[model samples]
Target: MTVGTAGDPVDRSRTVGAVGERRLIVELTRAATADDPSTTADAHDIVIGSGDDAAVIDTAGPAVISTDTAVQGRHFRLDWSDARTVGARAVVQSAADIAAMGGRTTGIVVSIACPSDTTVGTVLDLNAGIVAAAHGLGGRVLGGDLVDADQVVLTVTTLGALDGAEPIVVGGARPGDVLAVTGNMLGASAAGLALLIDAERRGDVELLRRHARLVDAHLLPAPDLGQGPIAARAGAHAMTDISDGLVEELITMAAASGTRLAITSDRIPVGDEIRSAAAALDTDLRDWTVAGGEDHELLAAFPPHAVPSGWTRIGEVLEGTGVLVDGRPAGGLRGWQSFGG
Candidate 1:
């Protein structure tokens, strides 16, 4: 039986949904590719959009490139996170690496793998998320590949330009350099996960929202994109993104620079959200603050009195190797490893 004419209500709805998704993808693609006119020339030389297997980009100067992956079960769960959020997370985290290098993100290439059962709607939403994140960083997705797999996985590679700035390598730190951070630490994503695990648990839903920022932070972390350039402008000695636990990343920097780092527990910033969540979980907020991964904040070292505004001093570079928390070895798990428990 005909509910209406050939162009009936159901048909109209389906058409609208399809159009909306297409529009969303176009808008996202535009946003992702939009860049400063001056920078556009640089990106244009490398990109072959409109038709290509992978977008081409000119890797002039010391082009900073970084890649990151997000897996369904380990990095996200479909039951908890929507596809849009998952897509954005993939772009954000990868871009953060470029920002940490005191470089500007110019382009991205994303590879997505998903099960056949994944909905077309979900795939569009994921694309929207990726476009939004790339836009936020003043970069664009040049091209990528899609494939079928047992699980959903997104791998993103970000390309950046140093713009004549000195690459802030992890090895530049020296004794007497001051260690500092550009953003909050610990427990946002962890807290959100706790709530998702048991929604009935006594935690504020608003806190959950804040914790979801970690989802974005973990997935779509807005690294202080401008801060990297600012740090470089201010003569940052050394810098690295705090993707691994703060302590573990510090140890890595220390080793790279052939210096020791000592951080005081009292100096690390612990947010109330993290503190309260830690209490509820019977975990130490300090541990998460120091050892948690995926914060994506920039940890950097500067010569004494050379720090910039918006950065807080957390420790100092010492004359040896290894990292110390309040003058002792950080004895817990050193940091996060992709294959390690």
Candidate 2:
């Protein structure tokens, strides 16, 4: 696949093969570090960075680790997102997993496999984005690998520190715990995706202009990185991020906890942007709010009286087997099934 838009006179025209692996590594390291020591220094000690064989991190207690991968055609498209944004998304999504376990990101390692013909500028942009995202969460890219492949692929492994808090898992919810979410901007990403897809097919300039925020949500999702730890501290019984849609997460939690999660349809704070998009597309608002994915908001079960601030209480847990919406079985779009389509 084409790495970046061509016909430029600078680095975009310089292919990775032309730069050679040694020079490419040096450039990528420079981009990742950004020549700033403050950004790289954090509570998690780093003994060695990119120059070493492997990253050496000094940490206390068990580390919260998670790995997420993004591919050229499968996870992202150059036409939809720039190389930097793609890299940022990869780090954010992977870091969210650590947050779900009641930890904060401390370090990141990224691996990229792309065709030799890929532009060096694109890879550098991707590295820059990864560094920015990691630094934003008090983390840094320690080291990684680069190699030739048929398509552009990125795999990010994140390490997190939980401090003194216990790691929140999926099977901890009790019957009386209430369900809560982190942000009010639920479903906006799905709405934005719908608008983007529609624009590609039919070109709706007015729609794009009116719902630009939603489009931004789809492309640059800002997951509440701190809320996961907050929820854990506030006595959350079970927790997970809404990566595969709210309903899907609810089902996973329910099955894991062996309880039923009943969320009211209206209790979820769906914004006007999502509502407008649903109306324009002639689709049910629940499809976006309930079944949409990639918001990356924290979903947790807390005691009714212990629901923390910054979290909207949406439902209650009951002794049952699966998820329910308004006392009925959740039907229709179950959410993004990776192998389904």
Model number with the top lDDT = 2
Per-candidate TM-score against the hidden true structure: 0.81, 0.92
Count of clashing residue pairs in every prediction: 5, 0
For each candidate, the alpha-carbon lDDT, in order, equals: 0.70, 0.83
**Across residues 1-341, which tens digit of lDDT does each residue of candidate 1 receive?**
00111221222223223443333334334434453232544445454641244566775677999999999999887766788888888887888788888988877877777775666567667877887777677776676665668888999999888888888988899999999988764435544555455444664465456455544444445557678877887888899887776887887888889998888867776667667667766766665676676777788999888899878899999897777886667543453232123
Instruction: Give the winner by TM-score.
Output: 2
lDDT of 2 at 130: 91
Question: What TM-score quantifies how close candidate 2 is to the native fold?
Answer: 0.92
The digit string of per-residue lDDT tens for model 2 on 1-341 reads 11222232346568988876666777677666665454445533676666567878875777899999989987788888899999998999999899999898888999999999999889988988899998888888888888999999999999998888999998899999999998888998888888888888996568877999888788778878898888888888999999889999998998889998899879898788788888888978877788888988889999889888889989999998777876767643453232122
The C-alpha stretches of model 2 lying farther than 4 A from their native spots are 1-12, 35-44, 331-341
| Candidate 1: segments with Cα more than 4 A from true spot | 1-47, 58-60, 185-187, 198-220, 331-341
